[model samples]
Target: MVFKCQEDSFLKEFTSKVVTCTEGQLKTVIGGKITTLSCYEVVLEDTIFFPEGGGQPCDHGLMDNVAVLHVTRRGTEAVHFVESALPVGKLVKQKIDWERRLDHMQQHSGQHLITALADIYFSYPTTSWWLGEGESYVEFDIRSVKPLNLDKLEDLVNEKIRAATPVFVTVYEEGDTELRKVRTRGLPDDHKGAVRIVTIEGVESNMCCGTHVTNLSQLQTIKLLRMEKGKKNKMNLYFLVGGRVLQQLSACLHREHQLTALLKNGPADHVELVDKLQKSLKCANKNLQAVLREIAVREAACIKQQVPIPRYYSLHRKEADSDFMSILINEVGDESVLLFLTVGDDKGGHMVLYGEPATVAQLGPQVCALLNGKGAAKGPKFQAKISNLANRVKAEELIKQYVTCTTSGC
Candidate 1:
C-alpha cells in the first residue's frame, strides 16, 4: 500500500499505531565478527519511513526512542525492523532521519531532472541509475556521448536547476497513465492500480515511487562528472548532486593547496613542476648508482689483495642491494671464498651468499634457518630476507662452523 513518505517526502515525524510485531533475525557484523541479532519486525498502521526500493536506500530513524535498524517491504507492507518489540495496537511516535531523507530526495530528484533532460535533448534514454555514496550515475543505451552534446546538456541542466522549477507528484489512473504517455523507468509487471508520476516544471514526467524534493533549487547544484563506456557499449554518466558537489569542491581545493605547497609552485604549474622533479630524481639516481659501482669495485679489489684469502668473509652494511653484491663477487672472481652478507637496517635485511656451487647448495638452507628466514638457491648464489637482526651474528657463525675444504677451494 502507498505510505506517507510517497505522499509527502518532507514528512519528518508522524504518530502511528502498531499493527503487528513479529520476532526475526538481523544479521550484522561487528568487530569483524558476523552476528545474528534478534530483532522485531514492527508494521505500523501508516509510516513516513520509506522502504528500500526503486534504487534508493531505505530510511533509518527511531520509533518511540527505540532505534529502527532497517525498513523493508514484505509483500504489500512496509516492515520496520527494530531491536525490541512493542505492543501491537500501541500508538507510538515515528521519526524519520531528516538529513538522510532530504539528501536522498535531492539526489533522486536531481536524477529525474538530468535523466529527463538527456532524453529530451539528446534522445538518450536512461537505462538504469545508481545513487552512490558521494556521487550517482545513470546509464544510457547509447554507445558514446559526444563532447558537444555533453557540453550542451550540462549547460541546459544547470540552467533548469538555476531556474528553481517546481516539482510535484501525481497519482494517475490506469487509463490516464496511457493517455499521458508518460515515460517510466520500467514499470513492474506485478504493479497494479494507480501510477504515481513525478513531474518537473517544463521538463519531464516519470513514474517513480522514490522520495524527491519539492523544487529544483533544493538540489543546489548538479555537476556531470564524466561519461565512460559501460557494459554492452552503454554510456555511463557520473554526476554529483547538492552537498556532495560542495564536499567534492572542498576536497579538491584542499588537495590543490597541498600540491601547490609540495611542488613549490602555483596550481597552474603543478604538472610541469612534478615532471621536472621526476626527471631530476631519475638523473640523480643514475649518478649515485655509478658512484656505488666504483666503490664496490674498489672494496672487492682490497679483499682480493689480502695476503691469505679468508675461509669465510661476512659483511654487514645498511641499504646495499643485489647489484652491489653481484659486482663485488664478480670483482673477486673466486670460486673459493664463501661470502655471507647482510644488507639493510635493524628493522629487516636481505642476506646473500656467494661461493662454489657445492658450497652454496649445502649451506643455503642452513644459513636461512639460522636467520629465521626462508629462501631458495641456484648454483653458487643464494638470497633470503632475514626476519631477525639479532640472529645475524649467529647466522654468520653457522657459516664459519659449516665451512669445509671439500665444498670450496679454501
Candidate 2:
C-alpha cells in the first residue's frame, strides 16, 4: 500500500477516520531524564505521517490537536502513537511536522544523489547509510578515500543539486521485470506493498522506502564533511545537507570567535599561539619538578637531624608527586623512624608508609582501611592509593598511637 504520505510528500493536512485505537506505552528521554508515557496506538484509514523505515526516523505530528509521539509500520499498517485516544470511527484532522519533514526530505534526496555519483564516478557502491540526528553518511565498499577523489565527488554532488535535477518515485507491482534492475539491498520479509524506485532523472534509480523531495533543488546544498574508517573494510563519507550545513557553519563560527578571544589572536594564528603556550607550560612544569625534589631532600634532612629522631613522622603535600616521595625516602635512609607520606588533593592521592618491617606489616592494613585505600607491604615499605584523603588525619593518628605503644611497651 502506497500511503498518502508517499503519494504526496508535501502534504501537511488530511482528514482520516480512525480504524483502531489501542492503549500503549512510550518511553522517551527529555533533558537527560527517561520518561514513560501512556499513549494510544491508532491506525487511520489514510495518513500523512511517515513511519520510521529506510534509515529515516518517523515523523511527529498532531491528530485532532493531540500530539503524535511516533509512527511505525507493522506489516502493512502505519501505526500512530498518540497522547490521547480517539473513537475508532471518529474523523480526525492530521497535520505534519513540516520542518522535520523538510529536513528529512533534503537529507534523503541528497543521499541518493551522492550515492549515485559515487558509484558512477568512483565505482564505490554504498553498502550502507546512516541518517543521524545531526549528520548523515554513506558507507562505501572501500577501505579509504583519496582527498582529490573526495573533493571531486563533493563538487559533482553539489553541481547536480544546483542543476535542480528532477526526482520522482516509480512504483512497480511485485514481480515487475524493471524492479530487478533497480538498486536495492533487499526488501523486508514483512513488506506488503508495491516496490518504490526513487530516480534522479539522468542520474540513477534506487529502491527506497523513505520520503524524499520531488527535486534536487530542494536540497539547497550538500557539504561532504569528511571520510572516516568504517568497520569491515569500508569507509563512511559524512555529510550535512540543507539546513544542517547552515547550522554547522554557525556553530563553527561561534567557536572560532571564542577561540579568538581566549588566545588574543585571530583565527589564522590560533594554532601557532596554542603550540607556543603548550611549550611554555612544559618548561614550567620541568622547573617545578626540580624545586619539589629539592624541598623533599630538605624535609628528609630535618627529620634526620632531630635530637632523638622522632619514632614516627607524617607529612602530606597536596601538590607533590611520586618522584618527590622517592627523593625523600632515599635521603632519609633510616629504618628506625617510621615515615607516613601522602601526595594528592583533598579528593584522593598516593600514600606511602616506610618503617621497620614488622611495624609496617601491622599498621599498613589498618591505615589503608581507615583512609579507604589499598596497598601491599613489601619488606619495610608499604605503598597505596588513597581515595578518601579527608580521612588522612585519622590514619595518621592511628599510626602515632601504634608507634607510641610500641616505643613505651604499653
Which numbered prediction scores highest in TM-score against the true structure? 2
Tens digits of per-residue lDDT, candidate 1, 1-410, equal: 67888999999999999999999988767788988889999999899999887788889999999999889876568989897999999999999899889888888998898899999988998999899867889999999889888888888888988999999988877667453667765656655666688889788778888999888988998889999988998999998888888889999999999998888889999888889999999999898788878978987888888889776788776757778778888888887888887777767778888888888988888888877776889888888887776888877777876875444656
Worst 10 residues of 1 by lDDT: 177-186
Per-model TM against the reference = 0.78, 0.84
124-191 in candidate 2: lDDT tens per residue? 99998999989999999998888999999999999998899999999999889999888899998999
lDDT of 1 at 49: 95
What does candidate 2 score on TM? Answer: 0.84
- lDDT value, residue 101 of candidate 1: 90
lDDT of 1: 0.85
> Stretches of candidate 1 above 4 Å error?
27-38, 173-176, 189-193, 286-410
RMSD of 2: 3.7
